[model samples]
Target: MSSALAQTLIVMPAFNEEDAVAGVVAEVRAALRGVHVLVVNDGSRDDTVGEARRAGAAVVDLPFNLGVGGAMRTGFKYARAHGFRYVVQVDSDGQHDPAGVPKILDALQTHDVAIGARFAGEGDYTVRGPRKWAMKVLAVVIGRIAGTRLTDTTSGFRGAGPRAIEIFAEHYPAEYLGDTIESLVLAARAGCTIQQVPVTMRERAGGTPSHAPVKAAVYLGRAAIALVIALWRPPLTLQPEAGTTP
Candidate 1:
């Protein structure tokens, strides 16, 4: 039983989240039993590594801050190498409620990727001005391309099955919103089952969000270009499955 639990890895990508990493890791442990927790400390200048380790999570200290996508990519590679059957991502900044991770893991019973969507319903997550508009636009564009509606294109709380873990290990993006946006499109194109579940988010455990207003605008433009490019790309190396998880 102990050995079997080793196949599931809960990855937390952290940068300057010292204030939140310990509590977040603790919450994950409390919420999910027997799952291995890994903290990918992305060159945090603070005590993220020390705190996460002290909180009883395995720590992978990156040489530099690789952003969320890059840090998560590294985590996926580790999961792939270690033969983890599932990878559930948790936000180190405490925005993602650890209790919600089980929902994603459970969804993976039928879906290849399960996203904890803040806007799926029953959540207080909302942005203002152009960012909100961009999110709505992205939802439509991605919904059309993915053949399903996805309310939150920027939520980092997600889970991956074996195949997704393998693919993302090799080619996960590392830019602003790169982890959430690119991963969704790639997973969709791969013909993997994708799903979203309603989840309420928390205020950041600590540190600022990546989506500052100025950065959000630049990211909006860049993400738009990327989304268009994704339309022309062929499906991923993994075989596409027929039908999807509702």
Candidate 2:
């Protein structure tokens, strides 16, 4: 296989997505030809693992639910171990459009990380009012901390090149923070070059959102505080091994 064909892996974190996981995996496989797909089944109570495997993705079953952060970190560790050159993170809720995978891959050629920004494009879907406000607030806070204007700090659709994959696999934040903003901010502080691309996301097709509106606001508030504290203090330094790219 060509280098581009062999080096990419789509990492999906799924929780009780038995109904949607298969379709999402198939879509990713179809959209990114020659790229492998790995689904981190976070102790799902249903048949998520079996469906993911049947849909042509390799499955990593967590012993118990570790939330999104834990599942994604597990995928990152696997990417680092297996020497993948790029890792793309997507939710299994059927909201993210897999057709945009190529755009992310293209962005990775010049950026350490490429994130899909829902607010950056002409997306028919809009975030819930409360969540939208919270995202805006968090973005401003993260921008001040990272010294850059970050538009979509709470988006889960993101791509990490080799260097970023290695760094995150080694030293990702431990606590679950709902959105991936904290990790993105930490990556920025660590001197990673991050970029964002506009992508349209559809409304979720199956399964209820893990967070309700009020719960999401509270979660974002706490995570924002944690991110500020994390920025003030230096993070644990991790050295990449020889020959590792990310």
Candidate 3:
């Protein structure tokens, strides 16, 4: 195992993703040799846990259904408790190519948060209507807060280094849209440096897309509220754990 791979954890928050989760986990393990992969089976009604286990991934099954944010909190806490120096969040639906994980992990060496950006000149992923507009606005706003340029602020393919991992394990948000937008705002407010790495995206191997065209307007409004709530809250502070190095 490479030293970097040994210290890093790949977290996949899966919910009813039995059809795709195993393949995604296998791809991650194969692409990043010897890196630990954890699947937070968020109360999946299907065979998510069994499939992930068969694919050589450690499984943490939640008691009940929690959205992506809640599942990720479990992941971050697991990483913190187990002394993982880095945590990368990858989608279980296979849209996030595992081949890009190493690039984000490499970026984590310099920045606290590394976002695998599909809109950053690498992928053909596109959105229309209010959703696209909301994304552009969010990129502009969150980018300023982090003191960097970001084209895909809503990207789920991201890695957090030791500092970010410590903070997130304690205060990760669990509300709707909190996993992506609010999480970025929270991290930036807490003084974590953020950077975007260009990455290619693929069609999901199974399951339906969360957002449909009919919900784009609603998504725009909800995204604005999520960002506002994140910023209105006071800055989050991290208390160092005894005898632990972040």
lDDT of each: 0.82, 0.80, 0.89
User: Alpha carbon lDDT of residue 15, candidate 2?
Assistant: 90
Clash tally for model 2: 2
Best by lDDT: 3
Q: Residue 7 of candidate 2: its Cα lDDT?
A: 92
Q: Which of the two, 1 or 3, has more TM-score?
A: 3
RMSD of each: 3.2, 2.6, 2.0
Clashing pairs in 2: 162-246, 163-246
Q: For residues 32-91, could you state the per-residue lDDT of candidate 1 as single tens digits?
A: 788899999999899999999999999999999888889999999999888798898988
246 Cα displacement, candidate 2 (Å): 9.5
> How far does residue 199 in candidate 2 sit from its true spot (Å)?
0.4
Tens digit per residue, CA lDDT, model 2, 1-246 = 336647988899999999899999998788777888999999899999999999999999998998888888899999988989888887898999987777788888877778888887648757766567877888888777556667787788889887788778866665656337768767777767677888888888687697776675576567667666667667545444367443
With candidate 3 superimposed using the best TM-score fit, by how many Å does residue 89's alpha carbon deviate from the native? 0.7
- List residue ranges in candidate 3 displaced over 4 A: 239-246
Ranked by TM-score from best down, the candidates are 3, 1, 2
Quantify how close model 2 is to the true structure by its C-alpha RMSD in Å.
2.6
